[model samples]
Structures are given as C-alpha cells and as structure tokens.
Target chain A: MINPHDSVIVRTMSRMLIPLIQLFALYVLFFGQYGPGGGFVGGVMLGTSLILGILVYGRDGVPCRAARKLMHGDGVGLIIFAGVGGICLVMGGQFLNYSSLEIPLADDARRRYLGILMTQIGVAVDIAVTAISIVFSLSPINDTEDTEPSRD
Target chain B: MIFSFEIPLLILLLLTAAGAIIVKDLISAVLILGSYSFVLALVWAWLGAVDVAFVEAVVGAGLATVFFLLTLFNASPKDTEIRRQPVPFIAFLGLPMLGLLLLFAAEDLPEFSDPKSPASVHVSPEYLEQSYQKTDTENVVTSVLMDYRGFDTLIETAVIFTAGIACALLLRRDSK
Candidate 1:
C-alpha cells in the first residue's frame, strides 16, 4: 500500500522510531520484576509501534506476513501459560504452583522466579499479538482498484 | 486526603469530563476524554495507586483513545450535536438514594492506610510479608498477579484474545 505521494519526513522518522519503541517494550517485559513496567504495558507499547508502522507505511509497510502469523498465534501465549501451570499440577503441586517446578535453580524461590518470568513472557506475547491483530483488523484496507501503481 | 493539591486536581478532572460531554464535535470529545483519562490517572498516582494509574494512563488515555480515533475514522465525519434526553425517574430518584446509601456505608470504611484497617489486618499483611520470600520478586504487585492470582489473569488473557478475534471477524472484509 505504499504511495509515491506519501511524505518523506513521516516515513524516515518512523523507520528510526519503530526499532527504539520495540526495544524499549522488550526491556519493559523482561525487567518487570524490579520495576514499574510489565507484560501488559510492554505488549501495548509493542503493538503501538506496529500501529505506527502501519500508519506510516500502510498495511504492507509493516511485515504483513508476520502480522498474519501473530494474528493466528494469539493462542500461543495462553497455551504456554496453561502448559506451565499443568506441568506444575502434574508434579504433585496445585495448578501454577511454581515451587513444584523441577528447574536447575538452587532453591524453590529461584524456581518461582523462573516460573514468574516464563509466565510474564507468555503474557507479553499474548498481549502484543492481540494488540497488533486488533489494529490490523480494524484498519481500513487500501482500495487496489483506485490506487495508482507504485513509482519505486 | 491531601486536600491542598487534590481539590484543584479534582476540579480539573470535573472540567475535563464536562468538556468531553458538552463538546459537539466527536473528535474534540474524544480528545477531551483522553485529557480526562490523563487527569484521572494523575489523581490515581497522587493517591499512591501507581499500578492502577499506570493501567489508566496506558489503556484509558493511550489505547482506548487510539481505538476511538480509529473507529471515528471508519465512520462518516459528522459534528455530533449533543441531544438532551429526558432523565428517567429511576435515575433522578434512585441515583440519589444509591448515593446516600454509599455515603452511609462509607462511614464504616477504615481510615486511609490505617494499620488497624480490615484490609491491612487481613490477608494483605500476609501477602506483603510472604511475597518476597515465596516468589523471589521484590514487586508485590507482580508476585500477587502472576502467582497468587494466576487463574484470574489467565481468564483475563482469554477474554482479550476473544475480543481480538471478534473484532477481526466482524471487521475484516472477506476476500473471495
């Protein structure tokens, strides 16, 4: 959906900003234990970056294929979350009993940390995919018939 | 109460809310609503509810505003005139009754951050005391959300997933 008539300033600025936004989102997701950020906020930021990309570059501006995959992979996060909980249950603890995890960590507390981190990652993935998918779904598709061919 | 600062903030919030309702243009109303959310977030943060404030800032002021703008763009651009509807009898009479009941109930609530408060004396203290030792997480909010209340979070995630899917199904034009 690239248009030759699109402004150069927006395209250039967004290209630079999008990567920084995604990086910050990742930092928030991983560093949530000691900070104010978490998976939900990080995921929203990531989704906002993708939405900005779409606004600047159009539907095809962001990686369209990856976006489609993310849309379908929305369930992946929940699966991971539930899977971890199920594993804990099978290991003779209650559901989501992270202390029951048989990780290589030195103690139960460490294992709990690992479990929480894993769960946060799952939440981040789910939220990010959902946000992007919602934006993609709601965005108006470009009319191919009326649009002129790309000049590039 | 932090009344010195809170009074002004509450006034500003009221103004923004009123402005949002009174504004004729839909876009203008949305912008005002965003401002209202921001003010509300600030008030929440001032009251030491940082997590709630963060969610309000992100979801209310950020994502919700963006979604509203997107929906606005999809619809025909029109200056929406606010039409005054007749106030229902229940709203006029029952609302005041409800408000009075709430005010009466508020008398029994523990003082703000009172050590002897039911909330402080109950499971909250245990959660605070044990969270770090049990979960190895310094942030009590994180420990509580991801560990103690994981089932609720899982359900919340499922709801969000369902919303995304529903939006996609309803909006996407089928490519034949």
Candidate 2:
C-alpha cells in the first residue's frame, strides 16, 4: 500500500501546518470573549491539530509519545472547573458565583469576567484531552496500550 | 446572513445528505458526509448563528470525518465495500412520509430572529441585554456558557470526561 503519510509533501506540509493550527486554537480560546468562539470550539481545534501532528509524525515520534502522556486526562479539567465553583460556595455565595471570589483588585463584573475566562480554560482543557483520548482509543493509529500483532 | 446564500446552501446540504446514503463506497460516503456538515455550517452562518456555525465547521466537518475514516480503515476491506442490496420497500414509503412530517413541523417554526418569537420573548432577551453587565464579556455566548450557565458547562465537561474514560476502558486493550 502507498502510504500518504510517508510522502515528503504530506509530511512537510503537516509539520508546517500543525503549529499554525494550534496557534489559531489558542486565539479562538482567549479571544472568544469578543467573538464567535468558546472553550469547546477552541478545544476541538487544539485536539484536531494534535491529531494531525500524530498522523504525520507516526506512533514513535516525539509528538505521539507526548500525546500518549495526555491520554486519560479527563480529570484535570473537571477539577479546575469544580474547584473554582467550590471556592465561590466556600466564600459565602452560591456555587459558581464569580463575584463572590472577591479579589481586592476587581469589582463584581470584573470578577465574573475573570471567572468566565478561568472556566473557559478549564472546559477547553477537558475537551481537548477527551478528544485526544477518544481518537487514541477508537483508532489504532495512536494506540498506546497495544502493539498490534497483525500489522507486521 | 444573506438570504440568497441560504437556499443554495440548504440545497447542497440536502444533496450531500442524499448522496451519503446513495454512495456505495464507505470512504466516499464519509467524505460526502463531511461536505454535508460543511454546507450545514454555511447554513448556520447564513442564519447568523456564527458561534454554532464555527462549531459545526470544526466538529462536524473536520474531526468527525477524520474519526469516520479511522474507523473505516480499521475495518476489513470487505466491510468498506458495500454489496449492492435492493432498497427496502418500507424505506421508499417511510422516508417521504418522514420528510413531509418534518416539513409540516418546520412550517410551524418561528420566523428567523423574530423579536416576538418565543425564544426572543423568553429569558434570552435578558441574557442579551444583561450579559455584558453580568460578566463584563463582550460575547454573550461566552458569558452565557461560561458564567450564567457555568454549572451546566461544568456538568458538560464532566460528561466529556466520562465519555473519554468509557472509551478508554472499553477499547484500552492490553495485547500482552
């Protein structure tokens, strides 16, 4: 079989494009406050870019190994999200009430602004990791647990 | 949000939807389905649902196609190649009936962006008017998603996490 990933054009192009895609994902994540994006959209882009990287780089490549470490990363983001909400409840306000966090540096709306940003980040992390994990488990291309006996 | 663009996009969406079923090759069907999502995203953007459009473009058109391709590739070659089978007699009668029923339902839908529409008259108006003051975020979508409805999003993230773990447990084979 002719493997497209082995082609010089495909590999070179993927290497160049992956970083650009990730940069755009970050832009979508942070600037979502002003535009048509949010944590989920940004996270998908981030995860897709990593997937593209793995596709071109192969399983033993540095990027694939790095992605392996990110497998089952569902808990990290959930903790951040719930922890922020828990802090609000602990501060004598309703759960997820951002203004109750009460930083001396900012007022109610500002506090909410910061809170939204924090939660967006948390959601983005959760989504990106979950997406990666899904692709890893669903497809053999990035499988970390199994060395496919049939391929060779 | 051009009205002229919507008709063409919707037409393309329908064609792709039909083409995905009509195509025999699994790979071709998956590719056509990706285009279907792309056209649907265009429809969403044309309808002024920019955020929803962005999501459909990325998740629907992009990752989904990749995922489908991956699954198809992992399957046997015989699985990828469809053996032609006659269309079920019930499908011919049922599909048109379903489509007509959907059309009847769609006809009752409120006009696009109608100020007095149920959605417009509901709490959305307050969300739109007060989101800036509530969250200091310029994008009300983010304000609503990450602030006003933060708990909902929190649960959604947990759901994604659960899905990830489930996939891992089910498919995380150790071929030792």
Candidate 3:
C-alpha cells in the first residue's frame, strides 16, 4: 500500500496548491476559445491536481465516493459528445454540424460557439476521468489500508 | 525565434535526454525524463504552438512522471536491479544503423518553421483566417478540433476511455 508522504511541509503545501491548480484547470477549460488553453490541456491539469491530492493526502483528499463518481464520468463525457452529435443529426443536418442546431442562438456563429463549448466540456470530462481512473486503479489498494484494523 | 533562448532549451533537452538514459537509478531516470518533457514543451511554445506545449507540459511532464512513479510502486527490487551482461551483437549493429537512417531522413525534412513549407501553404492558413469568423473562437486549433473535426475528437475520447478501462482491468485483474 502506498502511504502518503510523511513530510509536514509537503502535505501543507499540497493542501494549499490543489485548489489553485483546479481553478486554473477550470479557467483553461472555459477560456479555451479566447486563449491557448483547451479541453485536453485543461483536462490534464485537472487530473494532475487530483493526482497531487492523492499523492499527498491519499483518500482523504479525494473520497472514495468522489473517485467512483468520476470513474463513471468517462462514459458520461462520451455520451455528452455523441448526444450532441445526435441532436445535430436529428435537426436535419449532418452529424456534428454545429450550425444545424435550431436553437435560440443569436446567430449561426453563436450556435457554433455553443457547439465548441459543449464539445470542449465533453472532451475535458473524458480526459480528466481517464487520467483519474488510471491513477485510482494504481493506488486503490493503498487507500483500503487505512480501513484495516491495526495490531498492537 | 529567439536563438539565445531556443539554443539553451534545445541543449538542455538533449542533455536531459542523454542523462535520463545514462542514469543508473530508475527514479532518477524518470525525474530526468520529466525535465526532458518540460524542455521539449518550452521548445514547442517557442515555436508558437501553445496548445501543443500546454498538453506536453501537463501530460508529458506532470502526469506521466506521477504515473511512472506509481507504476514503480508495484515493481519489486529484483525487477529494478541491474545485472551486468555483455552487449548484444544486434544492438551494436542495429543502433548505429537506425541512427544513421533517422539522420538521413531528417536531412530531407523541411527547414524549421519555414512559412513557405508545404504544410503552411496548404489549407492551414484558411483555417486560421476563417476560424474566428465561422466559429467565433480566437483559438483556431480548438475550433479545428472541436468544430471542424468533431468526430475525430469523439473517437479520441473513446480511445482514451478505453485505455483507462483497459489499464484498470489489466492491473486489478489479479487483485480480486
């Protein structure tokens, strides 16, 4: 079982840093349209932050429930992306044709922008979940150690 | 491109790559490999590929190092121990031959960042020009991936999801 790092400074700093990293990840995800950030990078950063939490505090930083929920997020993201494509297909246009969605979008450009946003969100969710689950699978044996009874 | 900055980054990249391979300890090798990824990311950023650089920095430098370290946790000391053995004859012959082949191929590649290169002269410029107007996104790469080529991203997501599941299945198979 992998134990959390024992250094006080390491744990203290990770506690302070994880939230900031997650915030930056969200910024990268949402502001991707206007900047160098994008779904893939943003998602990677989000996963890295969670991994950092896991490295420093083990299961305390990320509860088992939360991790399991995120494991399912892998499929949720795929469903979201495919469902958006299906919506466009049902709207009487080619699959993933953003402009075909007959919504209350102000313009065709706006429709495209919404499509970009949704697709980016879906990609971000998928990548982040994959990264998290891979790490989780590697370290889950470690997390269960805390629950075991210790012998004197 | 700032030759002053680029030169050092390239040198550091080469040094890190060499150091990583030459290191005796697996942990040190992994750390050096992370630095190599970091320097490569900087080189990509210098070349004006910000999105690529971001992915390289986060995935290559940060997450990959962690993943390697975690994987190492499952490894035993016997697996990590190095044994002195005679170099294989095929490695002696094939390594240099492969290096020569790669060098020969590299010579024919286009010069770095040549605006008139075949890739630049192709449909790339149109994507850059029309991305903002069509998708209302300033980042052309994002628009290209998510808007123009959505199915490719979908497939990519599927692949990543599958990889995660496969990793979980392979690793957890014996535990339960």
Best by DockQ: 3
TM-score of 3: 0.90
Which structure is stronger by TM-score: 1 or 3? Answer: 3
lDDT for each residue of candidate 1 in B46-153, tens digit (9 for 90 to 100): 988777787788778878888888877777644334577877878988999999999999999889879998778879989999989988998888888889898988
* Candidate 1 lDDT tens digits, A1-152: 22322888887888899899899988878887877677777778887777777666765544554566667788788888888899999989989989998887349988888898988888888887888777766665645535757557
Better of 1 and 2 by TM-score: 2
Model 3 chain B is weakest, by summed lDDT over 10 consecutive residues, at: B167-176
Query: Interface RMSDs of all predictions?
Result: 1.5, 1.8, 1.7
> Candidate 1 docking category?
medium
The best candidate in terms of TM-score: 2
TM-score of chain A of each: 0.85, 0.87, 0.87
Tens digit of per-residue lDDT, candidate 2, span B1-176:
56677678778888999999999789999999999989998888877889999999999999989889878877899767788788899999999999999999999999877898988887998998998987899999889988878878998999989998898788757423
- Please give the lDDT score for candidate 1: 0.81
Which pairs of residues collide in candidate 3?
none
TM-scores for all candidates?
0.88, 0.91, 0.90
The better candidate by lDDT, 1 or 3, is 3
lDDT of 2 by residue, A51-144 (tens): 8877777776766777888864668888889988999999999899999997788989999998888888888888889888878877755343
- lDDT value, residue A124 of candidate 2: 86
Better of 2 and 3 by lDDT: 2
